[model samples]
Target: MKIKKAFPPKIHNPETVNFNEPPAKLLERLYSSHMPRSYKKVVNGKEFFSKLDPNIAYQKCPKLKELLDKMLNLAKKSQSTAT
Candidate 1:
């Protein structure tokens, strides 16, 4: 996973991120990540409060809710069919 570096290099420490807060634009721009750089303490040895909580993201960005719901539904369908 690539550490997303902004023009000034944003998160040097994951603990600095404000979780369950900030706006949609901020979420996408700063914290819209599947990479575990923030979450995996094995890599950084710091506790990072979640900014990518799906509920928070959905509340901030309705579009993300819709997209995630669709993806979840598709995954469920695929899993059921596989079974």
Candidate 2:
């Protein structure tokens, strides 16, 4: 005759198995609302016209320095307006 050994059943918390909530919900709970807004502005605004390199400006359009200067002035105006 052969003898068999029984193993214990696995136990898990019910909360760990469920993912009914959206991933954003977790982030929202963990961080303030301004966090997401600031993150987005930082990411998107990095591509804003002001950050472009002066060297590449010439290849992008004619009279690049003048164009870049105009863009910078406009950006400054907008920023001042916002505040």
Candidate 3:
């Protein structure tokens, strides 16, 4: 019988700094621009909180929420115009 070798799973340290990671401002912009609110028929309350990064999500930041709302509204308007 041939013996098979087992390899340990790769583990990544969450605390380790990753230079490849996008900056917080960019992340915030991306997150806000892409968050689904109108199409998903959801409000920017608890559901939004659940979908955001826990570390910065609970800060109750209004700018990010405003950006998201703006993006969602624009998408909805364009969608309506298309149809």
The most accurate candidate by lDDT is 1
- Residue pairs clashing in model 3 are none
* Model 2 C-alpha lDDT per residue in residues 17-40, reported as the tens digit of each score: 237554334434433333444323
Q: Give, for candidate 3, the lowest lDDT window spanning 10 residues.
A: 1-10
lDDT of 3 at 65: 61
Overall lDDT per candidate, in order of appearance: 0.51, 0.47, 0.47
lDDT of candidate 2 at residue 70, scale 0 to 100: 93
* Candidates 1 and 2, the one with greater lDDT: 1
Per-residue lDDT over 1-83 for candidate 3, one digit per residue giving the tens place of the 0 to 100 score = 01011111432443334576533433344445554433232443445446658445323545666777799899999999999
Model 2, which residues run further than 4 Å from truth? 1-53, 56-62
User: What tens digits encode model 1's per-residue C-alpha lDDT throughout 1-83?
Assistant: 24334324543433245566543345344443645433334333222233335575565555677798899999999999999
Clashing residue pairs for model 2: none
TM-score for each candidate, following the candidate numbering? 0.38, 0.28, 0.32
After superposition, candidate 1 runs with Cα above 4 Å error:
1-51
What local lDDT does model 1 show for residue 24?
Answer: 35
Best-first order by lDDT: 1, 3, 2
